[model samples]
Target chain A: MNNIKELLKEQIKFTDGYLDKYLAEKDNPQNIIYKAMRYSVFAGGKRLRPILMMNTCKMCGGDVNEVIPFACALEMIHTYSLIHDDLPAMDNDDLRRGMPTSHIKFGEATAILAGDALLNKAFEVVSQYNGNNPQRAIKAMNMLAVSSGTEGMIGGQIVDMESEGKDITLDELKYLHLNKTGAIIRSACTVGALMGGASDGEIKAVDEFAQNLGVAFQIQDDILDVTGDEKELGKPIGSDAEENKNTYVKLVGLEKSKELAKEYSEKAKKSLEMFGEKAEFLINLTDYLIDRKF
Target chain B: MNNIKELLKEQIKFTDGYLDKYLAEKDNPQNIIYKAMRYSVFAGGKRLRPILMMNTCKMCGGDVNEVIPFACALEMIHTYSLIHDDLPAMDNDDLRRGMPTSHIKFGEATAILAGDALLNKAFEVVSQYNGNNPQRAIKAMNMLAVSSGTEGMIGGQIVDMESEGKDITLDELKYLHLNKTGAIIRSACTVGALMGGASDGEIKAVDEFAQNLGVAFQIQDDILDVTGDEKELGKPIGSDAEENKNTYVKLVGLEKSKELAKEYSEKAKKSLEMFGEKAEFLINLTDYLIDRKF
Candidate 1:
């Protein structure tokens, strides 16, 4: 466990360095957008998505350098989504990661443009990839686009928005999380696998692992919302209940949500069995996720 | 002039057909987003960008089929920009092209998501390009991303947003319009030339033509906003004045703005001299843009 923690710390540091390089600020009139983008990107994210991608690539015996650009691009997409999600028109979140949201810090218009710029930058970065295998880079780019697009994250977001304050079935909740969080998480692993030259079966296995892990991660988030330290979580608890959101903890009791999270976590780990000792870190990461307090 | 108009009409039809096919709606719960995207896309505006792209490809002796996907994607990017520009937090416009804006038709959240989905769809469509020239396609894709990103459209938008209601200088207004309206227009031409397999010299000529034409088009827009008929323009005139926007007309008097538009139009045509008679269509198109009532 301690070894995994140390590895995660190092991975986060490495990912952040790449992110900073790719998203470096410019000295121009429109630098405000750059500042706004870097603000949200560097706002102390756990860098889970990029870390997952890099590790997946390494585990598949792929060159980390080839995967680095896509990993950073994925993180940028994730950051852009969060920035847009916290807009006044959407979630209206004022505080994220213990800091004022992008819109709150920089007026609504700049924040929106910053989100847009980041999304555009993601593709820009991927398109600039001059790897030996251009086809694989193109494939990874498409996966990132499709997963973050209407049929994936946006679809989940719309459903989640519509289902607010309504009684949604468990199936509906599952669909929501699967698209919203699951799609991007799945894309991270699959894109990394593709970059690493994984076969179809290996890609499928990683997809399954990511899908289950995404759901478990969301379930843990819901459970933490109900019973989490405000200081550790960096936001007030019960906000989900306050918003009347249809979270896992809301549909099921807290104890049941925890049990389901563990079940999904176990399933996630089970999907990685084919990788054997090579996937030990991912397996441990799954355990850490379900057991995380923050 | 009539021949040019006929060609424009046919090009718009062809482009719209491809766009409809690419953005076809699925019978699913999240189909609302598709509907919203199609709504704004099919809205009755001149498909100038796509038309320019297809024509540029044809003039360069490249296959129009290869450029069709990119043409559609460029239009999608343009549409998404309009959707975002009309948001309540931004321009707050209620009507566009004589119809309710996306945010007015659909709610704010859906409008934002629809914009995002369209942007993602642009990249998704481009990534699916299976032309023989994968390198050229990648180059075009990168051009699209950079031109529409912070260094291009978004950069222009931020500067425009910041300069609102401020007494800005002529150079500032030019910079704003160049980045805002100019980047995407220039991208349309340059990407087409690249995909059409134009030589570097030809691409350079097209870039210069587009840079001048973009400014001419924007200047003409400013002039129409003050002097043209509202029914012909499809929206109320004087909105720029009402918003205190730093338009070319506002910075330079109306007559000088018109002169500037004509001067830029002439320069645009001048740059196309290398193609001689083959560039007649684009030259006429330039005249049409500057002389447009809308």
Candidate 2:
């Protein structure tokens, strides 16, 4: 556990360094957008997605350098989504990662533009990949777009928004989480594997592992929201409940939700059996993510 | 002139067919998002960007089929920008092309998501391009992403938003319009030419042409906002003045703005002399776009 924690810390540091370089501020007049973009991006994110992608690439026998741009691009996409979700018209979140949201810090219009710019920048970064394998890059880019788009993240967001204050069925909830949170997570692993030249069988294994792990990760988030230290979580507890959000903890009992998260985590780990001892980092990651308090 | 108008009409028809096919709705849980996206996309747009791209591709001796996906993608990017620009937090316009704005019709959240989905879909469409020239497709895709990103459209938007109600300098106003409206227009021509297998010199010519035409189109829009008919424009005139927005007419007098538009249009048409008589449609387009009342 301690070794996993140390590895995670190093991954965060490495990811942040690459992200900073990719998103370095310009001296142009429209630099406010850059600032707002960087603000949300560097706001103490756990860097879980990028870390997952990089490790997955390494585990699949790919060079980390080749996947750096893609991992950073995914982080940018994630940050952009958070910025947009924090808008007053959406989740109305004023604080994210214990700092003022983009809209709060840079006015509504600039914040919106910043979010748009970040999303555009993500595609721009990936499109600039002039690597040896153009076809593979194109495939990864397509997957990222689809995962972050209407059929994936946005679709999940819409359903979640519509289902607010309503008693949604468990299937509906799963669908929401699967699209909203799960799709991008799955994309991170799959894109990494694809870019790493993983065989079809290996890609399938990572896809299944990512899908189950994504759901488990979200369930843990729900659990933490209900039973978490405010200081540790960096936001007030019960806010989801206050907003009448349909979370796993609310739909299923807390204990049942915990059991389900564990079940999913176990299933996630099972998917990595083909990799055996080579997937030690990923196995430990599954355990660490599921057992995380914050 | 009549011949040019006929060509323009045919282009619009052709572009719309492809757009409709590209954005065909699905029977899914997130169908509302699709509906909202299609609503704004089909809302009587002139399809100028796609028309320019396809024409440029044809004139450059590249098969129009090779550029069809890119042309449609540019149109989607244009539509998404309009959707976002019409949000309550941005321009706050109620009507676009005689129809209710996305936010006015679909609510703020869905409007934002629809805009995002469209942007993501544009990339997805382009990334799926599997022509014989994968490298060329990647180059076109990169150009599209960069042109629509912060250094282009969003950069222009930030400046425009910040200069609202302020006495911005003429250069500042020009920079704002050049970015906000010109980047994607230039991209339309350049990407089309590139995809059409145009040489470096030919690409340069189209780039210059599109840049000047974009600014001319924007200047004409400003002029029309002050002097054109509300019913013809499909929205209120003088809204820029009402909002104290900086425009070409506001920064320069009305006559000078018109002259500037003409001057830019002439420059735009001049750049196409390299293509000689084959560029008749584009030359006429420059004139028609600048002289448009709406």
Tens-place lDDT digits, model 1, residues A259-293: 99999999999998888898988888989888899
TM-score, prediction 1: 0.98
Tens digit of per-residue lDDT, candidate 2, span B244-271: 8888898888999999999999999999
Candidate 1 residues B204-223, lDDT tens each? Answer: 99999999999999999999
RMSD of 2: 1.2
DockQ, per-model, please? 0.81, 0.85
DockQ of 2: 0.85
Residues A95-159, candidate 2: write the lDDT tens digits: 98789999999999888888888889999888888889888998999999999998899899888
TM-score of the B chain in each candidate versus the native B chain: 0.98, 0.98
For every model shown, the clashing-pair count is: 0, 0
What is the CA-based DockQ of model 1?
0.81
Itemize residue pairs with steric clashes in candidate 2.
none
